[model samples]
Target chain A: MTSRRIESFVGHGALILGALIALYPFVSIVRHALGPAAGSNAAGPFTLENFTRAWVGGGFSHSLVSSAIVAVGVVVVTGAIASLAGYAMAMLDVPWRGAIMGVLLIGLVLPAEARIVPLYDMFEGWGLLNTYWAIILPQIASSFSLSTMWMTTYYSALPKELTESAAVDGANSWKAFTRIVFPLGSSALATLSCLIFLYTWNEFLLALVLLPQNPAVQTAPLSLSFFAGAERNTQPEVIAAAAVLVALPVVIAYAFLQRRFIQGLTEGAVKG
Target chain B: MSLGHRDVAAPEKRRVAGRALRSRPATRRAHRLRTTAWLYLLPGFAFYGAFSLWPLIETFQYSFYKWDGITAAKWVGLKNYIKIFTSEDALSTFAHAFTFILFYAAIPVVVGLVIVGVMTRVRIRLLGLLRTVLFIPQILAMVVVAVAWRWIYAESGPINAALEAIGLDSWTRAWLGDFKTALPAVGLIGTWVMYGLCMVLFIGGSQKIPRDLYEAAKLDGAGPFQEFMAVTLPGLRGEISVALILTVTAALRNFDIVWNTTSGGPGNATLIPSYLIFEGAFVTRQVGYAAAASVVLTTLILLLTGGIQALLRQRK
Candidate 1:
């Protein structure tokens, strides 16, 4: 009883400390984002200025729209293509399933940084640099794993009878797939959509390499790079608010899809 | 070995059977099933072939030629790869990966295990809130996380202010700017970013373990340590494999945290391979060399992770 009591006390203390440590940087950033700039009276003083500056100051409003456009484009393109690939993967008697799967598995292994060189050259050749499509198109193509994995899982779990029965009732393969399989795979679609959107939004290196000088075309994360430019003259308060603003949407999205997000990430790792 | 040969042989038999389709109605029906599948498959392959496969093949070809992403190809053959293996700068990037592995994987795994061990013992309230707070970082963009931590590590920043308050002012410096401490500082931010993921995985995996195992251990008068050793740890094996694999790969291809935090600065103290690839391609215009390094890194991750997956057996 005595040892258990002691252990419980130590465990609680450690747990609280660990949680605080896990949250240390976030809470610190929040404190700075809200804090008075050196010897101010109000608790979160000097900060409508910070918020205003963060919004208009960094041209974040434009970046916000640009980010939304890129993220949405990437998500839609990835979802549609992935859904097609995934659905087809599920219906495996298709010719070149072996060849196609082999190719995609290689795609899964190819890191974005590796491809940035060739992609930059390719995009430069096409005069697509500093454009939304340059970033979004490559990202959407990279969603092979996301779509194939989700679709395969959905299709694997789906009752084959529904598809066959629909086909038996004079429905063609496309019709059966659209009406029956698509509806059933809505959750997986939503999961993959969220994944693609987050991937597009969070992608930095490619965005950096592809769109660095063109600040107007920048996504939020790419835009946030301005604050970290090692320029030596940027202020902390402005940087803090900008960081906080960029993080807000993701946190909000996460709240809505928290369960699905966790499920997708955990399950995707196992399946992938 | 014969089975391997037989497996290859069977595919030919399948093709031959496929040709005799019209003679048998059942074979014709199967052939029709195959054709329908092709229609389903057409769009996906077209997209994959146009974008993914072509570019990937081009990437391999590019690695052999010394093009500055724009100029005439020099056809450097194996020189770019040989330089990658021999260069001190390239080796430093590998060193950065191992240095990151300490904070990135080792710290998180231990912390997560401890969190799980304690959660099993305590009847904690506000557990949901606790989980959310820890997890909030993982949801945020790496750019935001990286930038935020950068400010916190500034010379006259909160970290220094806190150090002053505690009379450890002498201990503080511009952490992210300090040459010696910069790599570890950037690495610690990775710990902050990733530990939440490890926690959630551990908690999820632990809750699924039959409570009776712990209950039985309790009846055996086992302490928390013993119960955890016997029950919690074993139960968490699957999630452990997952957390390790994800974090290890993240450590290898880590771009954002180091990019945004130090930019691998204070004189290349934290220059990782991902950054090297980025610099080689974009900054230096050594696209071919970058591709070679990328191939080597990808092959390394594939081998290491495949080994881990096989050794772990956490999957069916």
Candidate 2:
């Protein structure tokens, strides 16, 4: 009985310790974001002035717009394209299913850092520098794997005889797929779409490389980089507030789609 | 939700609409299908072809040339590649990246699995709340996390003050500035953020193991450790592989955190390949050399991930 009590005590102690480490950074960020307005306290006086200054005319507004443009572009173009490619792989007995999988999975391994320079060269050649498309186009491809992989899994689980029946009814393959496969894949699509939106919204590296230096075209994070003019003012509180603004949309979004988002990520482990 | 239920209702609509569509001509429908498929696919294809695939190929092409990105190109095939291969500084940057991974890969994956394993054994009242709190770091910007940590790691920061009180003042240093410790310091924070993700995956995967296996292990006088080895570990193979693959990839591409924190400072002690690539291309305008470096980096990731996939498939 004494040993069992000791074990329980150790277990609970560890859990509490782990929990505190996890929560500490968040508390720190919050503390810093609303640092005290006056008096020389390094930890601070606790005010909202930092947040207000960061949000109002503080140049994050441009990042908001740029990030939106790129994210929406990803959802509409990349999301839709991946659905089609996924549909093809899941349903059609194409001669190259394995090859297509290999191609997409190749992207799974290739990090943006490896390709950033090449992308810069291509965009410059095409005179696409400082344009929304430069950032949007690359991000769409990066997000393709998430969409295609999930959609294919969703589509394959669907009963095949339905499409076969539609074909017999002379609806042909496309009609059958649209009227049959697409509707069946909606739940999976919703889950995948939510993830894609969040990923493109949160993406940083590619945006920094591809977008223009112009204030209007720069993303929220990139704007934040140049905001204090690169290591001058050193306002950690204002930076945290700006960071909070950048993360706000995705946080609200995940709350709504929490179930599906978790499912999509854990699919390899649990569901599949 | 009604949406999930709506999907369950879709098959019935297909069934009802089937007979009426049969009266349509076959070839005409096939033609329409072709057009629709192409139409649905064309835009995405163009976008990826223009932006992603072409640039990948172009990276190889650019690596062979000496171009200032604006001026006319000069062909110097394989020279840039050879230089990077021979350069001590460039080689050390990769060594730095891999050294950081010692903390990033091993620690995060271990901590994550431990948390998940513990959660399974315990009946925590606020399990869901715990999961959400752990995941907060993944969503927060790297800049905020780095900035917050910078303060903590400062000489007079709370962390050092506490250490001094505990008679461990000798252990303190400017973590982000100290050449010896900077990479590990940044890497540890990454491990912290990532373990939460791993925990989340493991919890989902563990629930799927049949309860009978555990019960059988219990009847055989097996402790939780033995039972986990017999049941939990095997069942968790897929999640473990996924976590390893994802974490390793993130480690190789370690940029934003290190960028925000050190920027490869203290005399290039923290320089990783990504930082070097950024300097070569954007900052220095040695676009060609950066392209060569990028190709090498991409190839290394491909080989590593490929080896992992092979190992996982072989185990299966």
- The candidate that wins on lDDT is 1
Q: Write the per-residue lDDT of candidate 1 for residues B231-268, one digit (tens) a residue.
A: 99988888988888877888888898888777788898
True contacts kept of 2: 0.33
Candidate 2 docking quality: incorrect, acceptable, medium or high: acceptable
**Clashing pairs in model 2, backbone N/Cα/C closer than 3 A:** A36-A45, A36-A46, A63-A220
State the local distance difference test value for candidate 1: 0.76
Model 2, span A95-150: residue lDDT tens: 44576576667565668876787777677789987789788878887777666777
Deviation (Å) of A136 in candidate 2: 1.1
- Candidate 2, position B312, lDDT: 63
In candidate 1, the second chain superimposes onto the true chain B with a TM-score of: 0.87
